[model samples]
Target: MKSKLNLGLLLVAFVCVLACGPKKENNETETADTTAVSNEPKEFGEADGKKVSLYTLKNSHGVEAHITNYGGIITSLMVPDKTGKLEDVVLGYDNLADYQKDSPYFGALIGRYGNRIAKGKFTLDGEEYTLAVNNGVNTLHGGKKGFDKVVWDAEKITTDEGEGLKLNYVSPDMEEGYPGELKVEVTYVLTDDNSLKIDYTATTDKKTIVNLTNHSYFNLTGGVKGDILGHEVMINADKFVPIDSTLIPEGQLESVDGTPFDFREPTAIGARIGEDNQQLTYGGGYDHCWVLNADGEGMTKAASVYEPKSGRLMEIFTTEPGLQFYSGNFLDGSLTGKGGVAYKYRWGIALETEHYPDSPNQPDFPSVELNPGETYHTSTTYKFSTK
Candidate 1:
């Protein structure tokens, strides 16, 4: 009887071990030496007669992000809240066709020139070039068929930094009225430290201009939540570019001192957003670019956001010289996003890191010109946490 009991006890113990043992095999490579690529990639949709794919990128932490090769867009980003509950923070549509349709940039990658160029025209090397006038008189986000509207070649990548996807696209000479055959590669990595890192690289055969950035509208409390005006925002910028009637920079920087543009201190986005100010009136809200005050360059902290209710915090660090803090002023009630939620005005906010808008036209600004021999490289990381 005692021998039989011992055998039964051993069997029960073995069952428990099988059920509760560590799940390390799924996330095996925790160190730098091994490749830890996440599995499970699916076909997203077809675009321009090509099959697009969505890749799942997971860190050792519970964080996961879904990115599709079409436009190199992030379909969803799941991160943990203060209570250890994972939730999607970035805003987008549930359908792939909606993304390819009338939606805003959402989680798409912006490029060639991320922000606006003055009057859809610029004189590069004393040669004037004309581009598609999409946004009023200026060219916004690369033009009508910008980098955000095309397909990219994506491959699973695992570096010492983290596991993610490497998306490559080659822009033919003057594809969007921009010169040079631009070969570009962008890598999206979700590190174990609860951060999403974006590495951008490009090389041009001829002299061309480039300012690449990701346009992910974030709402820390989740996309389906209400307006983000209650969220606290702090940007390390002492100066901001003022806009004109058409939302193009006037080629000047104004001190943020004593103005609503001052985000030097953590303040509610709506605290002074409605102030009777000229800049606010011109932008219809906070839509202009702010010159960031970084400590001697090379990926310094640019901005940080905190959602009081969810206790979610996101910190932005980048090598770019300027940050565009848009308050989603144009998100009217005309469309619905993920989970059938209407995206109203001020529903999301974008903290886009890049060179100053119209950098090619503003000679005083940091040059966006990429010559044949020069390589264009920049990176930005968004770190998340909970208080």
Candidate 2:
């Protein structure tokens, strides 16, 4: 009888062990499967009369970036630091509705004319042309409907430069009343060296003004939590184009000396933003154009920004003559961003590579006229690295 009791107790202990361990393991397995299912990507909408899909590019070091064919916008850029934590370094929206309706031109390709046109009028080779006036008494960013909204004809291309994707769009004559059928092609090339090269090309059927640029708001602090107040910025410029109260250029190239426009050395963006300066008040922040110190030859370094916290650094190289350093002053707490984060004022920073603002109206400014038999070509690159 004692032997029988000993065997029964042993069996009960075995059963207890199974009940305690395997059952807990089953629960853990179920919870892990639930988490795995939740992390899968959800389906999104279509674009451009084709199978609009999102493409993800990853480097050998596991840095990933997502690009969608819709407007050729960059959805997100994930970079892994020395600690093996990946972060979305660029600002973007969550769904298609936010991007379609109230986008702040985030990660978009702005073209035809990147900035504004005074009075919606300009004289090209002594011929007057009137463009679409969408802003108050002026035209901003190509018009009410610009290239940023249109889905470009895209193609994945390979180049010795790097793995690249090319997008094409044809702006028909009088589409927005600029006077030319412009065929434009923009190439976003990702290099193995962590640089995003944007090359633009265009040809017009008639005489038209053209200036293209990319609007990518960057927050090197992983696009979360930290303001850019601590980031150091420098622009290779000695003179800047100041604007009036309407944020339109007043046809004068002002010196950066003794002004907040000077960025020869690294300075915080908010250092001179609140100063009692006329240009600051007119811009509501730093929205003016800086005449880049280029040799009038090829692509050169225009600007550089370094975020000490994340150790992510961005260098802007472009063939354009000017750069627009926008502090995102108008980004009020109205637009909900990715993961329902409210993008408050100055949430991101835009370093627009283009000609000066209102260059079409300013006679002394660089010519933006694109006529027949002449191709409009411009290139800008944003190279990223961690210090």
Candidate 3:
């Protein structure tokens, strides 16, 4: 009977081991799933008394985008290079405090009128409205507190193509001197094809001007250790909007032919950036808007950048009419970015797709007026590939 009892005890122990072994296997599978595609958001910090979270979105191709809802900012984007090695292709801070303290927009979303309005003044419906002037002599990027500064409500979504983060924010009437109760929804999707697609939709209760865009500073080299001067750029634009000394558009579109602004062909950013051009001097570098050539009205190829060393290529497609290519001219090594790297001049570049700058003030430009019954919608995609 004692032998029989020992046999039964051994069987029970074996059963327990079998049970625990599957649990470990299950845990391993869960970890693999999380690494492949995860929607779980970790607490980033508190912003404006509200809890902020950081979301990790990974695609089938292992492209990961870490986005925080504080400013709907993409803190880091890991993309694969020519060697199938992944690296962060965007510039941003490692922590929330750094971003909140000071940021050059980084990977945040811009809204309520991107670029600038001349002198922060725009007359809508015969009523002159004055906005908070942040840039010199103009209201830039939605003025003092643009969408980049506000916290947005975020929701994890599963798109048919890949993972998505849907962000929503409401701008009250007369907020930032804008005349509207604007409700904005922006969705960011990381596709399996290695594309970061942004979809924007907004509606307002009152007539207000609206222009939204993402301001992600990109360095195809995968980090801020080097500058983007060697990257070849090709903008599908025949005309470009020349800016004044204040960096506001001159309200007239000029042909890029025979000018340094000509990027109809693949050209290095530093090739003509130092040419004796007044526009270059005014903006300190290439901070002008290019008039994108359209082939219908839907999304068209706006611009492309290729880094030969890494064999990384990024193609921009947008439904907007204009594309602002701003070389990182403002960075002066005053701020330290990810990995304790100092952000220097021309370390990164911004390719912002939107309507023309100061659109509300420029009647000749595209109208940015959003009526109560009309809906504002735009989409931009930055597709990445290797040579």
Candidate 4:
């Protein structure tokens, strides 16, 4: 009877161990999967009869970004708030069809020339070049078929910092009345530190003009919960480029002191937005470029925004010379964005880092020319945190 009891006890102990072993293993696997970084690509439909794909990048911290090779647009960016909840912060549409239809450069890569060119024409090396006039009487955002409307080749890559998506496009000479066959490469890396870093590099076979920037409409209230008028903004600029009634730079830099353009300190976006000012009326809101302060250069802090409701803070750093602060004055309720939300006036803000608008026309402005054997390179970073 004692030998039989000992055998039964041994069997019971073995069964318990087997049952508990697998449960512990499964829990460990689940944890690993949750924290792992991933770069996933899915078909986003086609543009110009070419297959386009959307790439989703996630960092170890669970921050996510969705980008499409169709115009290298950032369709969605998920960030964490003070409560540790992730929410989409940028404005965009749900599908590729909406983006291709009537997007006002939403989360897109702007190129060739970022802002406006006076009268849709410029003289380059004793030769006259005419671009497509889309914005009033000026050439806006590279022309009708800008970089934001084309398909790019994309590849997922991993670096020591984090996972990245590399997008490449080759603009033929005079594709949109531009000069050179420009080979452009842009890489977006979602770092573990909760920053989206964009690095742009371009080389041209012929001497041509080049200015590139990303237009990501941001509403830090987590998916346009409300308008961005209440957000506090601070731009490190002492002077700004004033625009004419046509929204083209007047070829002169005016001091921001005592003007509504003075964002040297943190102030609410709508504090003086309704003031009786000519520049304000000309732009319909804040759609001008701010010349960054001279604080050493390369990768300096360009601007910072704080949203009180969500306790979200976004800081922008760039190597560019100018920052365009667009108050989204043109975002009427005509277009519906992600989650079927209608984007209204002042619903978003765009901080575009680049050279001054119409640099080709304003000879005094920083040159946007790229000669043969010379490479054009720039970097911008959008860092997020909870204050």
Query: Which structure among the candidates has the greatest TM-score?
Result: 3
lDDT of 4 by residue, 225-256 (tens): 98999999999999999999999888899999
Q: Each prediction's Cα RMSD?
A: 6.1, 7.5, 2.1, 3.7
Per-residue lDDT tens digits of candidate 3, residues 1-387?
A: 999999999999999999999999999999999865646798888989999999988898889999999889999999988999899999999899999898999999998888988999999889999899999888989988999989999999999989999999999999999998999999999999999999999999999999999999999998765999999999999999988889888889999999999999999999989999899999898999999998878999999999999989999999999999999999999989999999899999999999999888888998899999999999999999999
Worst 10 residues of 2 by lDDT: 38-47
Positional deviation of 331 in candidate 2, in angstroms? 1.0
- lDDT, candidate 1, residue 270? 97
Please give the distance, in angstroms, between residue 3's alpha carbon in candidate 3 and its true position after superposition.
7.2
Per-candidate Cα lDDT values, in order, are 0.90, 0.83, 0.93, 0.94
Give the lDDT of residue 345 in candidate 3: 90
Give the clashing pairs for model 4. Answer: none
lDDT of 1 by residue, 47-69 (tens): 99998888988888879999999
Supply every candidate's count of residue pairs whose N, Cα or C atoms clash at under 3 angstroms.
Answer: 0, 0, 0, 0
TM-score of each: 0.90, 0.86, 0.95, 0.91
The lDDT ranking, best first, is 4, 3, 1, 2
Per-residue lDDT tens digits for candidate 2, residues 170-211, read: 999977878889999988877788788888999999888899
**RMSD to the native, candidate 1?**
6.1
Model 3 regions more than 4 Å off: 1-38
Q: Is 1 or 2 the stronger prediction by lDDT?
A: 1
